[model samples]
Target: MPGASPAALPPAERAAYGRHARTRASRSCHGWFEPAAGRPDPVDVLERQSAARLPELVPIRYGRMLESSFRFYRGAAAIMATDLGSLPHTGLTVQLCGDAHLLNFRLLASPERRLVFDINDFDETHPGPFEWDVKRLAASIVIAGRANGFTPKEQNTAVRACVKAYRRRMRDLAGMRALDVWYALDDADHIRAILSTGTHREEAVRRAGQAAARARTRTHLQAFDKLTRVTAEGRRITPDPPLITPLRDLLTDADAGLRQERQLQSLVEAYARSLSSERRHLLRRYRLVDMARKVVGVGSVGTRCWILLLLGRDEGDPLLLQAKEAQPSVLAPYTDGEQYDNQGRRVVAGQRLMQTAGDIFLGWTRVVGLDGHGRDFYVRQLWDWKGIARPDSMGPDLMALFGRLCGASLARAHARSGDPVAIAAYLGGSDHFDRALAEFAQSYADQNERDFAALTAAGQSGRITAQPM
Candidate 1:
């Protein structure tokens, strides 16, 4: 079994292996939970991450995390990685969404223009235990459920529904042929059906339709109209300080600014090489017109993120691409680092593998920073019919439905990389794992509260600074 591959193992043998694993690592071990002694400090990890990020924007990141306990859990992937690394694992691996919080699952238009539900962030994605992703998803539900003021019973019910959905979906995928599993997709209609039984069914369906309609309209032209103005030279990005600032305004020297422009041009050229020839040809239709530093997401606040506005055929045509910095996955130190030298490529590869359909413009590049150091970044269309559900707006039942969707989607993603047959066998035809996950989710929810409390105290004591948006 030394070189045994999950993919190569036969279904019977894999099932046997999974049962054998269960004997050693009891189903009960899956429920075992506690903060490991000498766990890494959450704030210390944040500070270290900030070192590579723009210093001026670090406060915004902290402020976003400080907004609520659930928000803190979303931004504290590094902290949980340390804790998860110390947990008992089955040695089963998948392309993990290292930060599989409830909010990270969203609806977006696929290449075919159909809206599909999938994991939306890969900044910390890497190969890891499938259970780790499941655990993180469960914990996030618990924390978010608490944030929504769900009763303890309601919270446990949501966590159970999530784990049950995951278990059932994995079992379903385990039985499917390889090609069928690969072809499986959770589209908007499928998600609508899942939420159709809840008390807010009509409202949910109405919202889903509205979201789908809204997503279709959120194209490049919409973004261009909203963010750029018809300038004397051409369409230019309107300056919005702190949130969206053009690079020209930051680099004062004329010679230095010219060099920076050349560097950006070279970066895009390199990124184009990562795409297929057809996509590259399609990209050549546009000319890069303007770029601006744009702050995005709670955990991604300080990281170098830019939005490049490209003008296509005429004044009416436009394309927006986001170039976001890629660093080592938070799981890197806990497990082996990425195989690819380019972290950006690692992110793109993980996304392509886990996602049913991805942005055609997805690519990676290397950029020389203002500090003269190079960083890896992944580029993709910024507003490709994307829509996210606001957790605060949902009731307990809707949140539970969202939890189920997240669980099912995570199972599909893991099925692509791990042995779903074995995972299904490991899960068995029972709710034991579901109950165990509920217990673990609650325990971790308590830990999250403690961690959030510590972080809040740190901010209050001036150990960390926060600037709320």
Candidate 2:
């Protein structure tokens, strides 16, 4: 609504757009995405420009073999941008957990230790098209399915089923009581039904059990492995080679030092208020053990992340909390509400709204960062009952089942935030969005190949520092 004029963009922005047209990447993107209009094709434009602009991201290329599957999983996510950022849409939007791939939907324990399925990532959230979310979910299903040897037709059936289920779920949600809308999620009954279905029954049951068992907060006794040592001095974070580094390895600036103090000062007051008096009482027992600016997420390589270690009673007994900078919801600008100045606060609020049971430590704060830029972040447990079932690991049947679950979960999330009836009407019980998204997914996947090739070429030519394949 801010700039709804279809005929023309405002003059200053038009001038700036014209200026960017002269750049090499911009001109090259225009060759395909926006050939006649002098505008870059949105997908091509996005991919091409993003590939070049985000040089700070440690680019990961195709066919890179790693010793660990988790490392490979994180590396492979870079290519997913093609599907995530390129969807044709009407712009009806809601807060989205930006990385809504099939694998990202999983069972997490509620506070009561009951497993619940929901969206589990929010790193790339920012206002854009809702179709972008759906398309990403569908394509992740197909790609992961193909990797696991599923027929194309089989994948399509899964995709259609997901769309159908989402439509039905949205309709049901729209008719709920206002409070009921907020209360909606996978209840114990729903989990039992899915477990009874016998589709990947053994795996689901194991995951549910794991979720329940690990739902306990990581206390000091179990926090450290053989690597960490406790002495008379304050507890210090021991570094692991290659993967985990100490804060002293990277952080040196005195200014960066004060910035963290400011965050702590703000966080202490705000989060303390959000907690019940009983939880707050628990907080008084711990002293700030250590804090560090940490790196996190696959697509969120350059984003800001921080970890706080809290010591309770003795140095060895600790509570670990992570405060990561939350990017704005992709739907915020289009969805109704005040635009959040701090994206992290938006993320925390949105998560609480959409998730069935949230982390007890979840809270928000703002601070000036090491770069002297003002930032906002929300804090929570480093890992709750989170376990991603990799897309590439899914067999055909498993992939389809995964897709339906993601579709159902996404429907629940959107229904809680957006007007479910209108969204359902917009979907119209048809495959228009689904098929359009499938078409978009294929087109974008092809584009991902092109950009991946370009990035690989650039890396080979010594133009970028990429993880070697």
Candidate 3:
């Protein structure tokens, strides 16, 4: 209750209110899934979103989305939000990972040097219905199950495991002290135990330690070795077109390159203001060496992302930071406007509120682009022992186990900003919510396939462009 806003009603009354909500919007209604009347075309939604992004990179977003139905689902957060908005929800709000796809959860090194599993992406994070996150997470399992060749029964089992884990975890969190729930985190050992077994499990343990060690050791020196080389004039980042291309290569004019360098310098200075005083001082120790435009993630391909390589006391000491563009959350329209004007701050604040351990260098800034338009961006370490459970390679059993792990993690995240007691009461003791969610997952998966096919047809008909096969 330390940071929680005081409620007019007591805890028990709030919980009873949730139970009452079930009568108006029965837990059974969660199972209801059908395309709403006059639903907008998913492709059209995507095309409208593309208009605001970098024109050249839009095709890459479409290209990556074209790979599979699951990938399409990943990139189509806006489309899903439109559908989720039409559904009957409990009206209870929480900080949602608006794009809570399976791949977005990953392992990262905590500030304490321990490896932990958490929701790693927050580009679309915002306060919204708690069920929205759960629904999206459940649908991800169904889509991934299909992509991994799981049978219908196996996929249903995965969905059940996920929803059940969420229910059980919410119930557990509800009984615990509020401070305890805030302090809870999923460590590497616990996550490995839940998701891996035999050689895979043993490998996970080894990898966890290795990942921690690498995070500590993989500073600017390691990055310089991998991404830069000794040049006649100090060290310069090697150019890898499309993926990592230096600004110098993109800007032929010397003055133009200098202007970009100045812009980035100003951006970093503004970003430093968002960090703690200690972190700001720590950041000042490094000097920017090079920067490049980098494309990251299937859904984020079209966004403006840049990597800044910095040098510390000497060439041996280095740091790598990524500046990723942040736009309004897909949930924005449905919910009230955010308190923060800058979307980058919105993303950073939501991330800090939800995750147990957040990036030490996390910060936000706004900058004018080459086109003279302003954009908001958040900055953090590009990588810190980040890894994901590859759903495509996992068997049904392992995938189910991983789904449960993701489910529990998500529950803890929601509890941070939501009423766990209310959520648990709404779920009840039986598997009603689980079965309902499973059915909804199946129905949504079918819709995803249809939407994906629509996009493919648009591409084939030359209405929309896609990457070459």
Candidate 4:
């Protein structure tokens, strides 16, 4: 089968390859996790990342991470990458959500204006062993469960549930036609259906409906109403100090601000080139009115991010876009090296590959000379029916249910880019892999706690500055 592609091979042959993978790394072996004696300091890993980020915002990132162990885990992808790299893997590859914590799975509007549940973040996405993502997600469930004061048994149960869902969903995808697998999407109704099968069916279904309704209200127009103000000159983004500062306020100098504004406009034009012609034409209808530096996400706090306000047709019609900096994935050093010339393009490509549907305005651009240094950025609509889960608000049963949803969603995403047949066969028809991951999740959650304490000590000892938001 030298000339035959993996997808072209018979199902039996694909399953054989999966079974063969167990020789390189056994399924049960994944349960064991002990940090190497010479493991790199987790804080040091974070410091290395901070060197490339804005110095002023680095403290805020630290502050966010110091809030809890789970918060620290969200920002510790690079640390985990090093740990995971130290272990043997099965060599089954997929587009990993390098930071696939439970929170990253959320509700967002698809291109067809339907509220869909899917993986919403891709800053650290790259091709890697499929189990890496499963481990990341499983560990997150344990960590979140701990934060919510769940017993160890409850935490293990949640972790097992998540892994089981991933395994079963991969098996289902394996048996489906390639085109059907590609076309499958987990919409709001589908999520309600899944929730209805759980212990608290009525309550879960009601919450799902509420979440969908809330997401629908989070549109670009809603963002415009909340984040902008009508000034004497025109509509401008309201400044909210460190969290949101318009370019003019940052530059202070009138001449420098004007130059920076012009540069950003040109970058927007460049980003439009990456989109399809139809979307570009639709974009051309709006004119850039304002742009502001914005801080976003627990892990991405210090990176350069901007909110661009564009107005179309009239003052009432507005478009909000976010141009977020794209740094090299935290998984870069551990996995195969860089694959794309522009980091922004790398992010966009991965998102399009894994997501069932994407933002119509999604694109990328590289900026030059604005600050005498070049940087890459990916652009997308600022708001489109977005809703994130609050882990603290969830009980054990609900948390487990959410974990199942995340797991199934993750399996769908990996199936788009990896071999589901091979993965399903590797997982088999038992709970062996699920139990192994549950074990691994507990060990990693313990490691995460140690790392979080190290960060807290760093902050208290004046080794690192932390400014509460």
Candidate 5:
């Protein structure tokens, strides 16, 4: 059957293959978690990653990770990838989110101008076992629960809720037509309708509505107002020191500055070629006004991220785009290597495969001689109605509800690329898989705390610098 395509198989046969997979790795086996003998030092792993990043910005990455165990987990994707690689997997592959932590799931504005809840990050995305993403998400819930002072039982409750939703949603997707599954999406209105059926229906609906409303206000125009100032020359991005430094401020030499600016313009032109004809025409209407190196996110702080400010018709009409560096996925070492030559293309492809609707401006390009080197970057609108979640502020009930939403959303993403029929068959109709994942979540959370301590020790020993932003 190695030569046979699973999608070409009959429904019953595909399910049989799923059941057969249990022989290679049983469902209960997922409950176990212990660092393999002589596991690599977690801090050493971080140091290796920092080696390729901007040296001055690396300390900021450490400072952000040192904030809390949950924050540490957010930055520990590479470390976790090593651990998960040592474990037995189901071999059910999907376009993984690579770092599917709770925070990465958010509300994003679709191309149709509708707000949809989905996975918002793809820097670490690649093809790998589907359980990797689920485990990453489950462990995040447990770690977040601990941060919120939740009891062990309550934490387990939330983990189970998440896994249960994934199982049930996969089952539902298994019964749908292929085209229907591909077209299905979870919009904000649907999210509100789902919340309305919950035990805390009124409160849930109110929260959902408020979040959606807030997301709508986070448009490009809003970003322009907050990030730019009217200068004698024209409107320019306001420099905020280390966090946001304009291109001119970064290059002390006038010649170097002019050269870098030209490189940026070329980068934008290369990225525009990746877009559709209409989108390229739409983008040509805007002129690149300014660019700033911006530090963003807990794990992405050290990466090369640039915010491009473009003016459309006039000073009042503007567009903000983010060109973020795309490195090789953390999952790359654990799974088959990526198919794309450029990491940016790999990211863009994975995102389009998993997301129901994506950023219309999403594209990739390679920039050479920009900073005496070459790098791959994916470009997208900087502020497109994104709604972030605050897990630390959530109560036990709210956490569980949020977990269910994240789980369902993750399942939908997996179904788009992986075999939902096989996955549903493997999950079966019981809570066995859910309970196993819950147990694993607790064990992994303990491991995360230990890793967090290791990083703290490194900082205290002066082995690493941590400069708070």
Candidate 6:
């Protein structure tokens, strides 16, 4: 077990865990009705744990008014479900690309310049109801559609379209050859198939195509302007006003940071040894120029995410790699000890297994920071046309198209790890699960509202420091 990562639990042990998880899924056919084995009440658990976590998590409270635009938006799930605690189905699950909200689906360029659609986030991925994943997607459509001013009728239509498309794709998946499902690439053919079905969103799809076509390695010439200066000197990512800052400003000042930089270099080298030879060779050409502990995303606001500016020959030539702290997925509690212990490796390995062609630089490493607490991180190219259309940016027709694309893409991604044919068979030819999910979506939305309220109330009584919703 020497040098073994947390994910590298002994094969016998790993198999045992998988088996237990599978058994739990089988017994869960009655859903949460029978209560998860040794499970606490969902609401009670949420209030207790999330509240105890304090400023460790987001401290946002609801906006000032009951009728303000913000309050209406406050805690509304991406979709509405009646009760997630219901539903009878298989637990056939995988490390879901967790948090599959509608907006998480996006366009990223494969090394070959082929634009593919896939889940772009993995922070909360872990084993759970494949239905939970769908429930979230369905709800996001309703919530985001409402935000766009879609009429209730239009919103329902959009939500229904999202669900049915998942059903249709699941059916299609049922018939796919194993290799076809495994090796399927979300390439031009996939996008074209979804696009041809609608004329209303033609322009938007074209824009996506154009954006993807333009994605490539962050090259020296083109990226230099954004990265750094050579004003009679060397290269690096230029410090911007508010967003990008030098490593000195944030981590430590002066050569003291250079020492920390060396430590990181050692860590990165330790990381490189874990990859394939081709990747090591590709990595050798780049050296770290600068790094900053930059904040990223709303939910991920407090997580340790560092942007490392890398270079080849000069400051202008830049490649950005983000080394994000990969903590356990939020789904871990529900899953219990039924997952990879090294959550970081789980995230990286799952991404590589799930993504057809991942970033060449994708690698995981462990590092002990100045605090002496070790954290694991998976590093990858920062931005390579990995762009998603804003969920709120689309009108009704476009949102429907986007929803279908999201559903189909999710089905394909899940097919990479689980037997899609089996999942499809479970789904069958009807909309049973679809309707079930809609109910779950509504219920979960209500739950989120309550939880959001709990967080606000906790903050109001001086129990926790929080920003208003």
Cand. 2 TM to true fold: 0.75
Candidate 3, residues 214-273, lDDT tens digits: the string is 546654356668887667867777888777888888899998888888999888999999
Q: After superposition, how far is residue 368 of candidate 4 from its true place, in Å?
A: 1.1
Q: What are the TM-scores, per candidate, against the unseen true structure?
A: 0.97, 0.75, 0.93, 0.98, 0.98, 0.79
Decoy 6 TM-score against native: 0.79
Tell how far residue 135 is off in model 4, in angstroms. Answer: 0.6
lDDT of each: 0.87, 0.57, 0.85, 0.91, 0.92, 0.62
| lDDT of residue 312 for candidate 5 | 88
Cand. 3 TM to true fold: 0.93
User: Model 1, stretches more than 4 Å misplaced?
Assistant: none
For candidate 6, write residues 302-371 as lDDT tens digits.
4566677678765435677778777766566444334665556778887876677687778788887765
Instruction: Report RMSD for candidate 5.
Output: 1.1
- How well does model 5 score by local distance difference test? 0.92
Tens digit of per-residue lDDT, candidate 5, span 213-288: 8999999989999999999989999999899999999999999999999999999999999999999999999999
lDDT of 1 by residue, 1-469 (tens): 4377766877899888777768656666878899888877878878888888888999999999999998889899988998899988876667898999988888877899888989899999999878889899999988888888889889889888899999999999999999999999999667877878878788878877887788788887788888889889888988888989897897899988888888888888999999999999999999998888899999899998889988888878888999999998999877753488899999999999898869999999998855689899999998877777788877778778888889999999999877898888888898998998888999999998988888898899999999998
Look at candidate 3 and give me any clashing residue pairs: 220-318
**Best-first order by lDDT:** 5, 4, 1, 3, 6, 2
The local lDDT score (0 to 100) that residue 281 gets in candidate 3 is 97
Candidate 4 residues lying further than 4 Å off, grouped into runs, are 1-4
List the RMSD of every prediction in angstroms. 1.5, 9.0, 2.8, 1.3, 1.1, 6.9
> Candidate 2 at residue 93, lDDT?
54
Model 2 whole-model lDDT (C-alpha atoms): 0.57
